[model samples]
Structure formats: C-alpha cells, structure tokens
Target: MKESGRKQGAASPCAACKLLRRRCAQDCVFSPYFPADEPQKFANVHKVFGASNVNKMLQELPMHQRGDAVSSMVYEANARVRDPVYGCVGAISSLQQQIDALQTQLALAQAEVVHLRVRQTASLSNHGFGPGSPNSSGSPSSKLMGSQVKPIFDMDMVVDQASLGESMWSC
Candidate 1:
C-alpha cells in the first residue's frame, strides 16, 4: 500500500526540514504544525524566531499546549514581519482610535436629533397644540413628541446629577 504516492513506511520532509535542507525524523516536532504544503508558515516563523528557538519552545511545552504555542508564534511572527517596530500593538491602537471617533460621531448625531425634536415642540406650542394648551389633546403627534423630548432637554437636572458624581454613560 502507498499514501500520497509514497510507500506506507516512507516519510516526507516537513517544511522546516525541507527549508533547512535536512532529513525529517519520524518524530520531528514541527511535522504536525508545519506541513510540507504550507512552507510559508514555517518560513516566516523561522525568519523571525529562528528554527532553534522554535524547536526549543515546542520541546518545552506539553503535547496539547504545543499547538497553541505554535499558533501564537506564527501570528506574532507574521505581525513582526509586517511591522518590525510595533507589531500587534500598532494594530490595536489603530482600532481603538477608530472606536473613539465613532463614539464621538454618535454623540453628535444624538444631539442633533434632540435639537430637531425641541424645534418641533416649540412650533406646535405656537399653534396652541402645546402640552399645557387647551388644544393639546387635538395633536397626538405633539403630545408624543413633548413626552419624548423633555427628558433629553432637561440640562439642569443632568448637570445636577453629574455634580452628584453620577455617570450617564458608565457601564
């Protein structure tokens, strides 16, 4: 019988061994993670961490943990190759900046909505359909808008609460 066009007992060199130009033993540590088909995985790792360091790291870890260690090493190695100075930290900082900018934009949009609703309430009040007017019950839209807009526009109450050390957006 044969497997992958080689005899059953025959062994093909893994990526590490092939790149290093050496024979792959039956119990080679890199064979499981660095297969022959994905040579670049091992090449980048070898470039950043060196083959000896990878070998030592794998040999120091337990059987189950070695796979995770290899995965982390590959990710860090790839990041290091892409950005040698900052690596993964640069990516994280960029994402955090985007989040902060989006949050600021969201706050501005909410303020605009509140301003529009306040204008609508003032217009209705001028037409005798305001909350306390005799024709308040005649305009269902005005009543609903008045009820919704009051809480957001109560700046004095919000300022008082903030003075009491209560956070509005706290988790």
Candidate 2:
C-alpha cells in the first residue's frame, strides 16, 4: 500500500513548491501554511518578497510566531501589489483624514445646536416664559431644554459635503 494517501507515489505539492517547480518535501515548512488550493496567496508573497527571502524568514521565526508573520507579510504583500508606491501607509492616511473631517463636522453640528438653543432660550425669556415663569411648566420649550438625557441632534443627520471645505466657525 502507498503512503501517499490518494496518490500512489507522489504527494500534492504546496503552492510554494508548485510555483517554484520543486518537489514538496514531507518536512517542508511552507506546506502547512501555503496549501496547494490557494495559489494566489503564495504568488503574491513571492512577487513582493522573493521565495528565498520568505523561506529564510520562516526558518528564522519560532513556530508560534510563524503564522502571524506570514499573515502580516501576506497583507503587506497584497497592499504593495495594489499600491506599489505608498502601500499600506496610503490607506492608513486616507482613513485618518476621514476621521478628522468627521470630527470637524461633528464639532460644527454641536456648535449649531448650542446656537439654536441660545436663540430659543432668549425668545422664551422675551415672552415671559423663562424657566422660573408661571407658564414655564408644561411648555414644549421647557420640556425640551430640561430633563433631556439623550442628544438633541439626530445621529443619522445628513452632512453637506460641499460645506466640508468651508471654515468651521463663521461670524
């Protein structure tokens, strides 16, 4: 009986060995990680970092760290292939910029809410319906301004993209 399982004499080569056109040894380090099914995984890694270099790296790393190292290398390799110049850094920068823009938008929205609240309070005072007034109880404005725990702004409010470039504060 052959020890090759389904195959008689030869065993299926790993992706690395298949790409390199070499025999996949029984103790091959890459066989466990780079299976024959997913050829593109190894191909991208090989394209970004040479097979020799990858082999050396895997050999140098401890068994426990090998998987994480391989995952990081694959991610960086894929990113490098997509954006040769900036790679992962460009993606990170873009996400950070988006965060900053959203923060600014949030600040602007909060400021507008405060401005409107001040106007409403001043109008109430002018009409003798301020917080201490007799008619303040059961008033819609008093109920809205007092004892409200939740944020006043609608979280899903649409922001105007055109206003992103404008100054955050206006006189």
Candidate 3:
C-alpha cells in the first residue's frame, strides 16, 4: 500500500510520463532504464517515439527538390553506363561495315574467277582443243608429261649458267 500522490524533490520524470504528459510517480527504479548523463540520448528516444512530427516536416519540403535530387543520382548512373554501351554499339557497327565490304569484295572476286574461266574455255575452243581433240593440252597424257619435267633446277647449275652467260656477254 504505497502512496498514490506525487512525491517531493523529483529530479526528472520517466519517459512514458513525459510522452503522455502525466505526473511521474517519482520512483527511482525507472531512472536506471534510461541514460541519465546524456540528454541527447533521451531526445533521440523521444524523436523516435514521436516520428509523426518528423515525417510531417520531411513531407513539407518541395517535391521538385526531392525529384531533382533523385534524378541527378539516376542521371550520373546512366552517364556511367552510357559510355560502355556506346563503345560496344560502335564496335559492332564497325564490324558489320567491314563484313559488308568483305562480302562485296568476295562477290567481285567470284565474278572475276567465272569470267576468267569463260575466257579460258573460249580460247581453248578457238585453238582446236575441244574435249576429244588430239592437240588438246587438257589431255591426261599432256598433264603427265608436264608433271614429269623437273622445273626445280639445282642452285649450283643456275649459278654456273648465270656466270657463263655473263662471261659470254662480256666477251
């Protein structure tokens, strides 16, 4: 059966009593529950419990400022990403252009090969070297005879011949 009225000489009130705006019981037991030395710690606790006021203050700030702040951060991130993407796209476009040019060159080369083959066939026909003709160089016997001729002469023989030709010309 403790006293129900407020006690005398109370230093400070409990947090709950302060929040509720009520008279404290002046009990020393609740003092150990909170830090007594630092007033900022108690203030922080009060602010955390009373977050509605803080939120209202933040909401009162201009919308454009918040939007611009967010947009600036996003713009910086986008700028960082853009250079690499642009470089990759440029490289791909360059490779595609090179491939297109190579394809055109290949088509031209193929056309030249076909034209040369036609010309060779026309010349062979005019020379009386049609498929079964005896004078045709395309014959297997002619090819075998060509293959048997050794075109790779010895280096010593080439040097001797070159020297002999030079001496004869000098004389």
Most lDDT-accurate candidate: 2
Q: Write down the lDDT that model 2 would get.
A: 0.77
| Candidate 1 residue-wise lDDT at 92 | 79
TM-score against native, each model = 0.69, 0.73, 0.33
Query: For candidate 1, lDDT tens digit of each residue in 45-143?
Result: 999999999999999999999999999999998888999998778877888888777766766666665566667668767877676877555343635
Q: What tens-digit string does per-residue lDDT give for candidate 3 at 46-100?
A: 4443434433433565655644433443343344344544544565677888877
Sort by lDDT, best first. Answer: 2, 1, 3
Residue 156's lDDT in candidate 2? 39
Scored by lDDT, model 3 comes in at 0.46
**How many residue pairs collide in each prediction?**
0, 0, 0
In terms of TM-score, the best-performing candidate is 2
Worst 10 residues of 3 by lDDT: 151-160
Considering lDDT, which of the candidate structures 1 and 2 is the better prediction for this target?
Answer: 2
Question: All models: lDDT?
Answer: 0.75, 0.77, 0.46
The number of clashing residue pairs in model 1 is 0
Error of 3 at 140 (Å): 9.2
